[model samples]
Target: MELLVKSIALKSPLYTSVHLIIILASAILGFLAYKRNPNNPNNRSFLMLNLSLAVFVAVTYLSNLDLLSISTQIFINRLTFSIGFILVIVFFNFCLIFPEKETKKSFVYQLLIIACLGLAAFAAFFDWMAVEKVVSGLVTFRPRYPGIFRLFFYVYALFAFWGIGILYQKIRKLKGKERTRVQYVFLATLLYIIYIFSTNLIPAYFGRRFFIGHTALGAIVFVGLISYAVIKHRLMDIKLVLLRSLAYLTMLGSLAGAFIFFVYYLKVYYQQFVDPDIVFVLASFIAAFGFQPLRRLAEKTTDNLFFRSNYDFNEALSKLSAVLNHGVVVSKLTDDLLGELKAILKAQNGLFILSKDENKFLYCLAKNSKSVTIEELEREEDIIKLREAGLEVVVNIPDDDKCYGVLALGPKQSGESYSTRDLRLLEIIAPQITMAIKTAKSQEELIEKVIEERQRINQDAHDRIYNRLGAMAKLSEAAAAQSKDKELFEQLDSGLRQTVVDLQKIVNKDTATIKTNGKLASSLKKICQQHQKDYNQAVKYSFKASNMLNLDDMAWDIECILQECLNNAGKHSGAKKIRVNLAQNNGNLVLEVADNGKGIHNLDISNLPQEHLGINGIIDRVAKFQGIVDINSNNDGTKILVSIPLG
Candidate 1:
């Protein structure tokens, strides 16, 4: 009789304990899902299902506790089963909408729910299914006509298997860690189904409960597995939820424990010891004073254990701001920014685009596998389409008229879409990036402008010096020719002739000219011979002329252009030889200057400064004459080809 009593006490705790654990775990999971995404109707429904399950389990456990009479037990059991049946039906629907799988078997799912409701109703109203009784001073339930309840169990088993199979198929198609989570859920559910079948069928077959503890153990294992998946895989940010819950729990636990201890000690001091309540009051005062500090300590410990890596959102934003201020290279800065964003938001992909032109955008940086090109996305139409489709394409263009660029970030990780907060973050960072690009462009333009101004000044100086020297020579000739006395005539003639010769030398500086009424070829030959001697380097000058071209502003410009070319070759190129050729090609004046010297390689004309005298002046003069200047150079030699359109 004692052994029987002990066995009953042990058996009574089993159902109550198992059900309580399930209720607690389910409540925790449901609360977390709801907290993370309050807008999701599926999450709300799942929370409802979990709450209903908890209530059903609690009532069943109370009935098992024998806190109520036999009739009450029967009523409670019926209610519990009804609630469980409803919860199971809701869970089936929740799975359907939550995972968002294809509903090929919708009719079958609805029919199963209907059948479960019918069975639950039958069991609740009639004794044909399950009967309640008092045996050995304990309330126990036994199936009167096992066939009806067995059918319900069989249907439950089938649905459970179907759910597991569906999840398995889905898992197979999924990639990465998400797949592993789904697979774990599948295994846990499979275990749960097996345990359910064994608890019902095995007990009924053997005429006694066999391995009843296994069902409780299985429930604990399944919930534990699910909790592991939620926290480890971050299925829904369950760690944060759990940490928050634990925070509240710690505070409540500490306060409740303190209050109870205070009241009990007060009672013991006053009633049992027959002492004044003063000592008890003093003790209570001390305990109450310690509550806040204790609460703080508990909070600190819990935070360290669970919320260790959790960073304040505002603090992270400040850190990001600091990073941006450092003026890092755009690519490296972008990579770091994206990495931080991915970690903070738990996103999958991030891309950044900067405006390249008024109508074009260049993808300056990308963090994830998002492919876009500057050439392809040149229109506003594509941008609008992307935004409409819910991509976070943050246009960095300011409200002011000067705005030009757009920044695009997109396709967050985990297939979960971006939120309003995400849009705001992108908006904030977009301006910073735009400002950086603008600063860089402005600096570049300033440098270019400085270059242009310097080049103009150098060319003006060269022109003024040449004009002044020519005027001085004309004045000296006029003064020398005006003298008339005999001694004065001889001296004046000699001096005048010398002055004229000096003036002629200035005009024919490059070569000696032959005086003739009309001899163009002879003049050309003389000019070519003069070029060979004037240039210290070995120069082969070849001249080919179609007609005697009339000298005009065009002729002076062409001569100046050739002089600039020769000056550059002599000063810059360490050449041993040169080739000067003048000809008429395609009704155009063509002058070719070639040198055997180290050539200009990879010359970036765009970045050339205004103070660059040699090349800049040559280019400016050629441009003024509407002429073409082609410069080709290699390690072997430099070649300057000048072509001016002539009639």
Candidate 2:
């Protein structure tokens, strides 16, 4: 115990430095692994492996320091051995599952791993593995002479070899990015194996420590290689990790070194002149004042050194904000925003998706990559490969309540992850994009409404009013020939012919403005009868005119809705019997149409596809009156109910 304290007081500089490096490297790697993907088994295994390595190195360092009592040292030694065994097990597990998971494993293989772990646990506590002793005011642990120690070494080696076999097998099966990941693991494992053999196996067998106890520091090299692999190969956006680490460590190291220099100078040159307490206070004040500034400077330097593309992120956002402040043309918005985001983010590919309907994307534009259609991307499971390829997924583009679109920016050109700043800027600008899209959609719908109104008037004039007028003219001419008083008949015929002309003129004028007060009920009845005659279907319809007021206001909407429903029933529903009911109730005009045919399934009326023109027209016409629609459908039949308030 006394010797242990002496060794700590006279701690080796090399030993202390090596211990710090090992500890820092292990912590950083483990943190990164867990942070990247906490739930992923592969990442978890990697974290565990790193933590075990840390424990192994830490205990070894503590035992060497000899600051603790003999019992404490022995306990630490046991922990070290136990962690070492656990490390190999974790590594083997990582090899089997990382990069890409292996789904199948034999029961025997699992039992073998368990058996190896049990043996390791036994070896960790058994004094036969290594026994502690003190000599020359220093504590040292001696392993069992070669022949016996070889058994434990061989077991660990066998497990390592199993991991190597798994890695080799995986390398053969994997391709592209996954293969690269496995290759990294293989290289890291190779270095670790070499380090263990040279530093540990050789020394224990030969009964001599190499490199004057500096050999243990070789573990840092192994940790570093693995860390490099994780940073460079597997995870794409480690720029944050690298930059933050560099900034903080550089700032800390500089401050610490400067303080040490100042203390040394003060002690050696001005011990008599300077008051030590005052100097300490001054140093504290300087450090406190300098901390933030130093950190900022270091952070800037790190960004400039490692992330040059980020320098213009703010500038890019400002430019985008300016562009999006104008008219909302969806196509223009998608095209422009996607291009800007691609440039700003330095991404290889991008997708701008806007809601075409309630359930699907209406439009998709791809920049700097092949265009993947919405149908192609609807399956979530299939896009995993694409995600790995740098798909920066952004969904519900505007806000949570309203998802106007989705934006997927591909991997950055420099293979960096999307920074928080970049995402924040995007979130900030999402509303502007959404407003623009809505405006564009509104403009489109208005134009379509105008065109449709004109077509309906022209078609209705030719099909209904014009034909009726022509038939009435012929009937009046025949009646004039049959009249006994030729003069009265001539006048009557002239008036009747003039009435037909007036009606034709009225039909050509704005159809909605044409009064439909007395005509709405009769018009609905005629439509139902005509549908029955046209399609040879049993169409039972009834219209109750009581309390139905101000019919002219809703006349156009009702006419269109009824026509569309009848047409759909005839053409699509394939029904033998159709029922139409029209009544005024609760200050609202109510219309219900039911059909005994195949029901509408998987239908979204808000975003109906192009082929359902009848249904689309019905919805559009009803919407003009701020009507409510309810559709009940099943395998047996379909029923539609529409209600438009009288107000």
Candidate 3:
């Protein structure tokens, strides 16, 4: 018994024990992660590595127990090393699944696999590559053909470094939680490589077993750190497997300990040893039987801890669709979306940008947990990508297959990541959002069309009715001029003159267009020449356009408004001198009409009869095109300043 204990101690059974513990722990984590997210290639790869490591550790432990012959032990040791090499190769293949580097570089991947296979072959077949035997009661590998194994080690090191380099590069480019998770993976890989290289080198250099226990210790620490990272930060959403594995491990350990105790206690009475195999079989059965129930419990616990409710991202999108269908204003729609997103996503901040086109985005809505600048959120490339991807909802917008824009919500509370289910929900709701936006846009366009049509009809009616009345007034004046009786002639002339003035006022009120030549300055010159010939007042008109003013509807409207003001000054002001000027200043059309006339300081313009419509008509017409109208009177003259915007 003393010799057996001495052999176990000398062979470092504790090292094998710790190695088994680390392997088992890693296996549980990998298994749980795989069970929860089987499709995640990373999880699957890690699980494969864990299973391979567990097998290697178990065989190593059996070899240390000296339960098999020396030749058998040597074969198991080579087998263990071969398995480890294969697992490392598979780890690289897993990395290739979502490689940080361009995955299209197929040659690189093929070369990597070929190199791995070559190393595996050399390790398995070449006796000189790896020769294992008991050295000082501890099983160890000695390289007889150091050159080949050294070459293999260097290649393996290069591969490990390459993976670490890729992970580091990816982490540097990633932001927030992704960066942290990637960093954790890189660090874990770095520690693993360090342990392997350092342990292997220490034996080679000193010809001693200085690293036997240390390598296992390092592995234990590395795996523990990685498992913590997996759970705490939800790196790759691996927590489900990590948690379930831990639960099962705890249950199995407790059952195994109880069975061992029961066996020991029953030994004296039965005079027979209870088989450990039976306990293992029973424990495995219990664990298997409990899996479903435990999984359900885990799911419920996970729901309570991480995903409190069924976050119906689709439901929020449906509400947005209803608002849009109702033809709600864009501002109101933005507000509603922001509010709902904040609640549904449990976001720290929310931003919704509606794309006007591929390049132009409108900052339509935002809500923030803290005081955040709109500019900062607007500038993020992730937001831009979201819009570009057209992932606003699940259903595609009917008119266009492309997305209008994205409704980006969160940075969720605690910087949690959006799960696959969350992304799917967004996809499902996107179509309804697109339809709502289309409906709203169509309604707005229709409203604008109606407004434009009504304005056209009003202008047409005003021109037609007043122009005919002006002709009738002129005919009455002619008839009055031809009357023979003096009293009758005087009566007819007075009535006709009054009628003509009334018709002129009507024409002026409705028809504001001033017929000027194409060259406005030349037209004003002609108007001055005509006024000088007809009136006692010396009329002077000066017109200028800073540049060639191409007149549109608004420009025309301003010209008409000015013309009405000038006509009123000519017919009503009765000034001795009249001046009209037109010029362009500061991208605005400025027209001034001034007349030298009785100031009429006491004129109660507001109290004017309903028949007098000039002032109100000018104001209303100017207001339609968002122009400004200013009227001022002094002792010597009346001046009107009309300014209209250029569209």
Best by TM-score: 2
RMSD of each: 14.9, 11.1, 15.1
Judge candidate 3 against the unseen true structure and give its global Cα lDDT, from 0 to 1: 0.56
Candidate 3 stretches greater than 4 Å from native: 1-76, 82-232, 236-306, 310-327, 356-400, 446-562, 568-575, 579-647
Winner by lDDT between candidate 3 and candidate 1: 1
**lDDT of every model, 2 decimals:** 0.58, 0.66, 0.56
Clashes of each: 2, 2, 10
Poorest 10 consecutive residues of model 1 by lDDT? 367-376
Residue lDDT tens for model 2, 1-647: 68665765588766687778888877777766566546556657777877877777776666555456666666665556566677778877777777664346789879978987886777667665344457653455556555645766677687787888888898999897678767777877777767776776667666753221343466776776765654455342233555567689999998888777877788779889999887777777887788888887787675555454455756877888767766456677678878887777787887766644532422232221222321124333434555654565353465445555766677778755554345556766777776767777898889888897675664454434443344345445655677675654564455456446545654566556758767787778876875564456899988875754457866766766776677667667779999999988887889999999888899777778977655665666677788888888888888999998777
Candidate 1 lDDT over residue span 1-647, tens digit each: 55434533665475556777898988888877776556555457657756765665565554454434566556666665566566566656655554442345467667877888887686567754244455665666666666665675666656566666667777878888668777776776677667756774457544553222233345666677777776556454355446546666777687778777766766776666645466657667877787777666665665555432344657767766766665446666667766777677665555554445422422232222133321123234453455454453334534244444554555445543333234446556656765665665566678777785564444543532332233334444554675443443443344445436434544443222323333433444443443343334565667788766554445444544555555456556777777788787897778888988888787655466766655676776777667787888889978988887765
How far off is residue 157 in model 1, in Å?
Answer: 2.6
Per-candidate TM-scores read 0.49, 0.61, 0.43
**So what's the TM-score on candidate 3?**
0.43
lDDT tens per residue, model 3, 1-647: 65545545565656757876887777776676566546555657767766765665565454454534456556655554565577667656545543232245478778878877877776666565243556545555566665665666666666667776777778777887767877777777688778867875435544443233243456676677677677667754555434445555555565566556655555545435556566556656765676666545544454445543555545766765565566445656656756765667665554445654523433232112111211123233433454454322221222354445556554557544443344445555556666666666677788888885565444433433343234335444654786554654454455446446534534454333433334555544554553343233567677677565545334335544544554456556778887777788787777777889865465454465655456555666777867787777878888877776766
